[model samples]
Target: MFARASEDGFIHDMVLYYGKTTLEAHDVPLKPEQEGLGATSQIVSVLASTMSFPTTTAIFADSFFTSLELVRYLQDHNCRYTGTARDNRIGKPQLGTIKEMEKKAVPRGTCYYVTSDDGILAVRWKDNKTVILLSTDMGEGPMSTVLKYCSESKKREPVGCPAVTRSYKANLGGIDKSHQVLPMKSNRRYLRLFAYVIDVSLTNAWVVYKRDCKALGVKCQPLKDFKL
Candidate 1:
């Protein structure tokens, strides 16, 4: 069903990374009673750490990541997840098939995926103002948190987190079928990075700064006064 039957159909994988921070709690027990690891833990670990663990986090995986074992692991560790589940995963009328879901109402339960350890989840959907989101987090009765992962706002990446504006003038490379594209200082995350650095350096005087320039990383060019 994923692939295109028509000649012009297209398919591609969707991947994402996100962060969450809001109400925090001290180290409770890394279990259900846990409030949170506070703010820093959310930034340093949840956002930065790449390693997966028992309590790493509960991320709403896409179809490629819909697995019962992964969700159960997060549940056991106090994390949570929700996402568009897969079509396979047999048994359980409550957790029916994808085709069944299309025929049923918007917010219908369907058997989505299973775990290696024999765990299964009944993926459910809910209609918000915009569109309906499907997930296995029916226990919360139905909520909307859209960050591409972990639809639960409470479990999402820390909110109001400062943006880390790091830059490098890397080559987009190859022929664009146009004139040669020369390298230019560009703000990857956003523009104005150099301006920020300039403002900081102007205020500090002693420290010089540049943004997203590979050449500038090793050593910045000394300012030369152009005598008119």
Candidate 2:
């Protein structure tokens, strides 16, 4: 399953299908449960892969999807996973009860095979501290293995935020010759589609600006700053 975001950063539609074979692709419309963009994305990616074959499956997630619901979702569907859990809140996973993970004498970067539903894990890549990586068919123990796998990825270079405002005379963020805002929505569908379109247009503009900056030595700025 997969989803396309609307102009307002909402997932207006979704597609769900199964991989008859590896690397298969299918599409479906958005469901009510996917009102939130984040859930829509999670459901789409997971459903797309597991709905077809029922075997030892592996899924990966960043910090956003490390929660009870997501964990239960994967378990209910019969799939293995390796996702980064937050410590206290966003990236914070409460590091208690996992005392067992700390007793070992493994090196910081050494893999600690994590094997429980939730426990402490030392992310050797970050400050070494026990964290959670709930999984079933863990290749190594629990904590270490999860950390090693999660930490193996190279550190991403920091990127600046995008400029969202536009400088075009026509405030037409979407299109047309008029410098005015979007049309007032007469229906919910209109509102949803309009918001989605505006957001996508904004994002597309940012990407273009960033690309141009990289290629033409121009500084990145908002559309408002851009003169026609």
Candidate 3:
């Protein structure tokens, strides 16, 4: 299943992947470009269509869901997006290759970036390893520092980090947080799918309940207590 969640762990939408044949049978909406980019990009487009507030929503996806075409599409739709990109998916930009960026002579925080004609910024930054990030909403400037443990130094040292990278790391854990509360074991072995669905439903309900409680200034029950 493909899911979109808020920064606080509220699942806003989900799409079950059953292959292109099933998607076509269901008449899932996909633009010409989205179709050409393949299934993962199509999923991102479908999820973007379901956004309650597209103009105000900022999407953060991992390399699995990010591509230059996807970033451009989201920008055209007026939704901001920031995500790490696979080197192959970032299009042909005049940036240093991963090997060059990872050389021992290069500084730890070295960054190379390029802007497309349509305003997509592709950045390659070196930390412990090279990370390629794409964004329609951020740039290389306004850099920040993050603490990383260095093996040679045997202590944590501050490394410069791009705003885009920092933001992605901070906000990409919403779905992970939601997954933490899901049941790991179930009694219905033969109906595991059904059990999994129920677990997700209950988790979403608890999130909504907590949201409402906070809005009304009331105490909210813990997930375990709420389930009981």
Q: Write down the lDDT of every candidate, Cα atoms only.
A: 0.30, 0.40, 0.84
Which of 2 and 3 is ahead in lDDT?
3
For all the candidates, what are their Cα RMSDs to the real structure? 18.9, 14.6, 2.2
Worst 10 residues of 1 by lDDT: 160-169
Please tell me which predicted candidate would have the highest TM-score against the true structure: 3
- TM-score of decoy 2: 0.33
Q: Tens digit of lDDT per residue, candidate 1, span 1-228?
A: 111011111111111222332313222113332324333222222321232342543343344444444444445545544444344422233443445446635332222323323233443332221111222333322322232223555454422110110000011111121112112356573444544344333423322233323445665555343121
For TM-score, candidate 1 versus 2, the one ahead is 2
lDDT for predicted candidate 1 compared with the true structure: 0.30
Model 3: colliding residue pairs:
none
* TM accuracy, model 1: 0.28
In order of appearance, the predictions have TM-scores of 0.28, 0.33, 0.91
Candidate 1 global Cα RMSD: 18.9
lDDT top scorer: 3
Name the TM-score of candidate 3. 0.91
Residue runs of model 3 more than 4 Å from their true location after superposition: 25-28, 186-190
State the lDDT at 81 in candidate 3.
Answer: 95
Ranking by lDDT: 3, 2, 1
